[model samples]
Target: MTLRGTVRTSYEVLTSRFGPPTFPQVDDGGLPAEDSTLWLIDTPAGRVHVHNWLDVTYFLKRPAAETRWSIQATDDAALPWIYKSVTGSTAAFSAGVHEFSRYSTRVSLARGYVTYLVQRMIALRERGERYDQGSREHRHQIELSRHVGHMALQVQQIVHDVEWAYADDADRRRWTTLPMPQLADEPESQHWHRWTRWTYRPVPTDSRPEGGDPDLVGMLRRRARDQVRFRDRILPANHRGPTREGKVELYDEHIGTLLTLADTALPDTVEQSRS
Candidate 1:
């Protein structure tokens, strides 16, 4: 059979759906099994062979649940069928947002999940350090840490699918579900100059969105009115550096900060960055 495609997924991900491998290596077999495990998936396209070919060498390095085995299939049309069978998604590869929730929904859920995963990882590290080396407690923590990391990657994979998740341009354009953003607890005067300080007003959260679609038109109006004080009442000043070289030098020195600010300020839309 000709190798048509490969599915880069973990053993658990495959076995949970396709059941255990039809041909797993002998339990007490000697090391270096060329085909460690083989799953014969009967897809609608045809029967395909999904196996960890020559993975015995590297499989032990990572947890079996997280290790990405290059599962191969021979049928020319088996890849799509395999994907459809596993995910139970009948839609075509180019399916649109009707097949899923809005992009903001997944993104917000991902944000919360990633945050929790990070906290779990940190706690695992701290707790693991307290145990003695080679002890069962330490080993258990190590296993838990690895699983937490694997979970983070899984969340990343799900949330990165933005094209099929987003509704449209109107649905894509959104805020963080709340008009009144959380502040840094301290007064803005400490960090901002007199100019930007006035723009940082404490708005009432009663009008903010609870969870679902927000009144973006109203939010924009309020945002502009509250933040664009310099254009209306305040007399703004424009000062240019003496030489182009000086401005360029300052920018070069702070390029990292500028790039970070740009990244946070201008996020890419699903349409703009669908790969």
Candidate 2:
């Protein structure tokens, strides 16, 4: 299929399932000659972003069917809805990569969902003390804990996928040699060198820094571990304690640490690659 054909087919499938998009598609200017298109569709599940782009390298050699396309959720809550709608299964809060295909279009759709679940886990942890034992909120938290545990494993799968995709002998050695990050350890270092070290230290056994962008790899690893901690330790422990007012503080600290590590390691611009 040509790039335009793939996009048209994708749009048709989406419209059939979710109705027409809220707005017209827009052309996002791209490198000299290639065309790029962006579509935004609002569904009960949340806003979905559909982007299609022509490869720029040896630009003329690739076929239109080869054009890359991505479908992503704009927010966390929309994920469950999308998952159910796409899979036709009861929305299990369980995590892992979810792929849906129609008319040759495939989407990897679990990362955002897991991220949103983590957010929920954090909120429940902060407010656990407000609910009486065996009450609705307490029961909900318990159920969510199980979901979060499954989600953590899903995140681990993603991390493992990345690690395998990019692993090399040197990368393996780096991980085996470095110390893993502890749950209490705050990723405070702003220098790329330090940030990279800290992010890899915690999962030295599974981490591979040589495969793709180091920063992106590190972020994924750190976030994966953070989710695991929230599911296994932080939330459970907090639920057992008296209601606390410091949830927001703790949440901010966690977000700040991730942001700092990201800022330190990510480059200002990413160059598009041709497949």
Candidate 3:
């Protein structure tokens, strides 16, 4: 079969196994090559993109249009898991049927575990305990910490996306109600601040509803600030020593705060964290 025809057949099989999708699949147009087909499925929790490119197919799920908790699978090896995630059954596949819900739960647990390790590392540093620059343990810790931090960032992004997706109208309005700012005649530097200023102009306090939760905007702003801080401070000091030590605390703090905010905003994340 043609690649596009194969993808459509796979999607049909999934729908038949899992019932109909939340909404009808729509053609999302193709790339410049015109050798691919892209279809979008809008679900209650998020959107799925089915991309058929040459001999390979990719299924990508994004919650609330956010890259967090996004899942992508390519080829037959990954198709079973995607199907199981949707159908909550592995009857269609003889083997290798993994569920997205379980995957999300495992990610959450790993994120928590990594946060604990970071805390311990901070405490060790606080107590003046030092590890040799070339020590195996020190290098391992640094590598593992970096990986965990990256994973946690993904999870937090997903949680925030879900929270934003399901937030009350008032909370949602905080984002939607803002007026878009016009770009200056001469755009400023490529820094995030410039992007933020261009994308999200602050709303007047008087315009917000009385007693409305301002935490939504605050969280978004903090996330942006932390991102800049991470890019500027932590990324540059990728080594073991006083330079990294000086920046580690702030990095951990930013990540920790993000995790806390995500968890607080979406306490029942595992239940609806599928992407």
Candidate 4:
């Protein structure tokens, strides 16, 4: 299939709307050899084909697909629009680069997201006064802040599950007690550094650095909760914006980062009922 634009989203997101995909030999308890985990859907423009592409190496590691799947269509001829129509996922229509199998834990994924959100929030603060209420820029401001609140909620309720998976509080603390990653002037670069170190101390390894300062779990959690309160203070003045006309722009800003993070802790992916 000719690689077109990609939608990095959850398997459940796909299956919820399209039913189970072409799960070839799923009952055999064997890893799929070909691109067997596939989906086909009809849209006004054309049929959309969704698959795992070349990310098969990790399939055995997970009998289930990743919390997200990078869908590369067979054609780009108005297919991006069709994809948005069918899957309701954020899509970018360009023959994008192929994605590889990436490994990430729930805690690391959430931590990386926290890094991106805080840094992005700082950037937004620098320009918040510039955005007029009910304007396009205002929408960005509202959405970003609201999502921060949403993320903080995710951290306390969902990311905590990952922490609890360990045998004891020390081990749990070890998972979240990471080191700061070096920040960048650019968002993507900063996100990569934050997530890649994902573990900066020898929680198991020390890979990325953020000025070498230790990242305390309790402090980070408190910081995120503070953002939730901050959003509430500002939300009364902000709405999703007059309409949904250009709301997906944040996807451009944050979606790619999300797929990169692949925070399985996110509840969006596990919504499927296997039974």
User: Which candidate tops lDDT?
Assistant: 4
Stronger candidate by lDDT (1 vs 3):
1
* Model 1 worst lDDT run, 10 consecutive residues: 90-99
Candidate 3, poorest ten consecutive residues by summed lDDT: 62-71
Q: Give a tens-digit lDDT track for model 1, residues 1-275.
A: 54433445566566678875676554556654345767777753446777665454454454255533332433223443454445443122111111222232223323333334444455675677799977767766765665555444433333333322344445434422224434556433222222222223223345432222233223323433432342233222353333333333322322222122222212234343344
Candidate 4 TM-score, true structure as reference: 0.29
Candidate 1 vs candidate 4: the TM-score winner is 4
Q: Model 2: which ten-residue window has the lowest total lDDT?
A: 100-109
Please provide TM-scores, in order, for all candidate models, with all chains considered together: 0.28, 0.33, 0.23, 0.29
How many clashes show up per model? 0, 5, 0, 5
> What's the true lDDT of residue 218 in model 3?
51
In candidate 1, the residue pairs with backbone N, CA or C atoms under 3 Å apart (3 or more residues apart, or in different chains) clash, namely: none
Q: Compose the digit string of candidate 4's lDDT tens values, residues 163-197.
A: 34332557646556766655657565355435544
Worst 10 residues of 4 by lDDT: 266-275
- Between candidates 1 and 3, the one scoring higher on TM-score is 1
Give the per-residue Cα lDDT of candidate 2 at 234.
Answer: 54
| Model 2 lDDT tens row, 82-191 | 43443332133223111222211111123433444454455564565478886767765655555544553444354444443446678767765766554554322113
In candidate 2, which residue pairs get closer than 3 Å at backbone N, Cα or C atoms, i.e. clash?
45-78, 179-201, 180-201, 180-202, 181-202
- For model 3, what is the C-alpha lDDT against the true structure? 0.39
Candidate 2 or 3, higher lDDT?
Answer: 2
